[model samples]
Target: MPSSAGPSIDKITEGGRVTQVGEGQDADESAPPVMTFGAPVAGEILAERYELVEHINNDSAGRLVWRGVDVVLRRPVAVVMRYPGGDSATEMLQAAVAASRVVHPNLVGVYDAIDEAERAYVVREWVDGRSLRELVADGPLDAGRATAVGNAVASALAAVHATGMVHGNVHPGTVMISDDGRVVLADARTDGADSQENDVRAVGGILYHALTGHWPHAEAPLHGATAGHGRAAIPDAVRDANGAAAAPRQVRAGVPAYLDDLTMDLLDDSVAPPSSDVLAAELARLDVPADDDYLDSNGPLRFAAEPGEEPSPLAAAGGRKVAFGIAGLLAVALIGLIIGISTLGGESDDPKTDPVAAPSQSPSASSAPAAPAVRDLKISAARIIDPDSRNRSEVRDAEKVFDGNRDEGWSTETYPTSNFGDFKRGMGVWIDLGEERTIKSVQVNLSAPGASAELLTGTVTGQSNESGDKRVLDEFKKNRIGQPFEEHDGTTMTFNGFDADQKYRYLLFWITELPSNGNGYKVGVQEMTVQGS
Candidate 1:
């Protein structure tokens, strides 16, 4: 082959077998045959073009996969290689060339295939993510996510089957979930192991595993097909005494009847499987729009703060501007009383000259503290924010943090595991004070101890939570108050040392890290108090 960058003959690891670039199957000496030739060292250039970066995974057929970079193109690729002089090597190269001809967004793109006398290799696109096997290992996916994944796989199969070819391999290991939430089917080993019907059946199996967290094809040879302890595991399809799989809805509560029927029909040997295109269309119908199913938490309120700091005043007035007008009327009435009192006091002893002098000093007196007593400032509105933009939940209950009730507070849904389920950066509750006001300090209480959080403040320019708090940090130029509290267990988050009379409108109480709640992770704010009258 002509050299794209350099021409070298270094063996690559198992290529497209695993969805992610660098993950390998569990180490098992009894596993299927792997490459007999020694593994390639890091930095070794293969075909003088693809430089070996890291070893990924060994395929079930025993090919070594590698993560490498195309020196000429400067793009990442996966290299699957085997030792020279075998029917398997020839089949691998031929399969790569064949797959390369079929281009689809859902299918992994093959770049090059070469078979030297010494070794055979196939270079393909690298997906920077985990396989479906890894994703389902944690637990079952939600209905919407499961449907979306199934639709992607079915669509990919529809294209491949249309070209008069077979994917041959459609197991979880061949399905990839990109880091950016894209779903792609990869690693087609069309060595005639299975027919197009088998691929269609596999899509049903994917949906089954996602909906139930149990691979109904437990007896199959696919990696991650069965759980440990010799148990079949929890699945929507229950195995009968004779090992027959039951309908999905029969085993799971939320599985819709139509989805349950489709899943079982595909798996049933007696029933003929639908064509890939037909199946793809059906799955598409079953799939709910992710946005519609998972509504984002409400965003921050846009209007300026209502005039009064009393709790729920904005809620009662039904409109922010109207409430602000009411508060303004109250403020004017209070000013009139103060002026009457000051005038009455000034008339004492020397009425004329002192009153004029007092009026002149009033501007200087504006610098003095307005109020001595600390009050609970009402939070008119709030929204939930995920810095990674992945965890957009909890908007409806966000105002509970300021509901003046410790018993009822706001909380994020429990993630699969702490660290935002390993998929999100962080989550926060952005509180809107209706309008800017002097902030003395804020007290925050959490449901549990040991979670980490920070007090962030920003000024609202136009509307709050309009863009889902995307510009909040930019608005305030990242104004952070107080050191981040890492050991917080429902303690008050006091935001002191703020300019005494400087008005601050928007505040964000962000949770950077969450403490373990035993069943995955959940963090809640029991109460939030803003003290400034």
Candidate 2:
């Protein structure tokens, strides 16, 4: 029998109800003992708070899903647990912690994370819904509904992208639709296996699956995505042997030509995917209007006008009456003000000094110091100073760092551990500021929080040099400027000291330490501003 305080997960036998053979029977009633289970059995309250009610499904990565309850709050929750907890579980818990930072209507809410050494689990909102995989299991959905689903997922990704984090995983299994018609994206992995561009491409797969009842990417970790082949066989654009995935229109009817182009463009590696916010807005525009005229995108509000209702009295009179009333009031006030001004003019006093006399100009005013021109000294060139050839390709492209756009800056690849993977010395961006000038300050903006770097200026005109040959700015060595990056407050690095005004043509902004971003060690320099003359 199910308990009133907590729901029962045990099955009923022919003879009677079935449960753990021995539960409270062997316990001493004086004190509640720390209940332990050999396995994740039902009725087990983990951390003495969450009670596991029923087992859901296990993910491809061996994370166990369970429908649990928060005993303190008396509310249902979903628990994703992994046993023999170590690095993998630690990564999962970290991912959960990072995901918890963002709150959105289309994102699954993370409640808490628990690591018991032996096992680690993430507690999240219990969504009463079905995964996108399950929804498209029988057949493809209608075109309009498919676009709506894509729009919601894209909006969620936009939020995640705004935070400088990627949703690494965005397959059918992670997309969920509630019984009450809510669409949400869930379970962001912090492993950094996929990039933001990959997340955009996954949306294309979702569109293809909804139109043809087949998974487009067979290698994707989505449940039931691959049956035999490496990737789910997609029709249409698969040229003789080039492995080009086909457009949706070629595989199924009713798929609009424009929609087909958009879908294929995402799947095509040659073409770059649009930003998540751009894609979301586009999908929203393409979504069909709801059946009711007054409902609009969302349902009607209490004071909203009905479709065929008569105009209200104020609206029928239009804005003319209100305008005339204000004008009349203004006329009365203007008349009284004109009379007062005339009376003051009649009683005017004698002038104290010449009204048109101008202030004397100083002799230095003739050569008025030319306003100090402040312009961004364009970077003559930039190159990655990676001593280790192994991590050469892993370095972010140098061109983006000086592009002047924060959204497209360079980023380092994910390291095995936080401190430069423990072996590598570090990586730096060697830049030429065209010609030497008084460098007043060097400002840097990073993507994630805690990163430590030094503004290095060297006389070496060569493109690259080893760390030993490079000279750190005197202020940094003196512990004046180039302080450690802040945890959450200040990301700006201003190297303004007595020595900062010196002129230097070659400058190296080197990162010596990486910040813990819940994931592994990764840092991105999005914007760099050099204020000098």
Candidate 3:
């Protein structure tokens, strides 16, 4: 569970029940104890004053049913366990090891873990909505809704894989609806590693049912027997005299072609499913009502994965060599220009001349002054309009998410809402622009203890080394804090400058204090506009 904010998790005790907690009730006696199995699991009952209620949801492995509390902190949560026969305790432990590593929203939260007594139980955030299996019991989801669900789960999986773990189990039955109006992935550990590859395969299974309303694995559609106003439909994998329901595109006209192809690919085992990274990229590209936001071909730069010596070392080093050479040359020229200016006598008579001379005009100026060189050359003025109007910004707190528009953005403390660790989160962006351009002004909107919004702006230009290309670019934003942004109240941070030209294809902005791990970095954006010289 995200340790970012909200409140602490409720602990478990022996002889607990699921049907007794709620919105406003005493903490000690909320839900009815487990009737099917008497008594709660033994422990200190960390919940200082809450009661247990009835079961809200349960899987074949364990029941995550809800229980109300009898005391103050009256909220609903679930206790998950699959201690029955088939799988051994060791297997469940391994599953926990893998599941505990992933920290993200869409995934369910795993609070407490008891590896003793040959039993393992996970306390997860309780969701009040029905199971997705129940939602599609009558039929699979329409392509539109299916795509939305697929996007959410895919994103969830991407976050899990980022931490080197797999969601071994992914079926309609394991996905759940939250009381908070968000989709939740409920069963990540039930399947284990043998299910890893199938785990990837299951994404397709989910998309299939979501789009067609039929279970490809089942002989006939599970929902076929369900009665509705009209005739029932069959799974996409199966054909009947009436024929399977029209293709997803036929059912819903605007379904993306990639999704249609992805579903069919699941039918064949010979084909390899996409990596979560690749799948995420594709889905991001297929976003709805599409227009051209700059497309980035390279990965992020902050943490560059190294290549083995055997791989073409020369090719990999070529770009860096050229970049280094350019930097060296620029350094030399700056030194030479400063020396020449100190010896020369000519001075500009232009009306616009100031106390400081311009670099282009005064090649012999004694000093170049900290003008363009001081600014992060990573960005240049691809264009500048209305020189008189300048924009300046500085990031004092956390990096914020850019609103689809530029002026408005929000922050997220617990970035990936599923993290098990106490400190983990970040703020990021998916930038859209025609080409690179220098920033002129930077503004950081912050909210600290007693303040609503603290705005700050400055000119710092050492960020020229950041990369924007065919790879991921998780660089410390030129003006962003090295630490992940969290704990601080939500803020809107913007960096602007006009002396440098940004050369990257797209700027997926991310600035946080902790680059090693995600920090509570959630920023929302409103809009960003660029002008031509």
Q: After superposition, how far is residue 523 of candidate 3 from its true place, in Å?
A: 46
Q: How would you encode candidate 3's per-residue C-alpha lDDT over 384-478 as one tens digit per residue?
A: 01111111001111112222123433332222232212332222333333444445543344332211211111232122111222112323233
Rank all candidate structures by their lDDT, best first, as comma-separated numbers: 1, 2, 3
Backbone clash tally (model 3): 133
lDDT string for model 1 (1-533, tens) is 11111111111112233444222464344653555554567899988899999776665455678889999999999988777635658877778888898887788889999877567788999887668767776766655677777888888898889899998777666778766566777777656878999999988788887767666776663643344422213333467788877555544433543456677777877877878987776666545444543343222211112446433645543354465558767988999999999877757555446645444556755676555677778787776665454323244466567655687677766555556656655677778888778788888888887788888887754333335455664554378877788766555566675777578888888887777776456778877888785
- Candidate 1 lowest-lDDT run of ten: 1-10
* Candidate 1 to truth, TM: 0.49
Candidate 2 residue-wise lDDT at 466:
34
Residue-pair clashes, model 2? 3
The segments of candidate 1 whose C-alpha lies over 4 angstroms from its true place after superposition are 1-38, 223-237, 291-533
Predict model 3's lDDT versus the native: 0.42
Clashing pairs in 2: 218-231, 218-232, 237-246
Q: Tell me, what's the RMSD of every candidate? A: 14.4, 26.1, 18.4
For each of the candidates, give the backbone clash count: 17, 3, 133
Cα lDDT of candidate 1 equals 0.67
The order by descending TM-score is 1, 2, 3
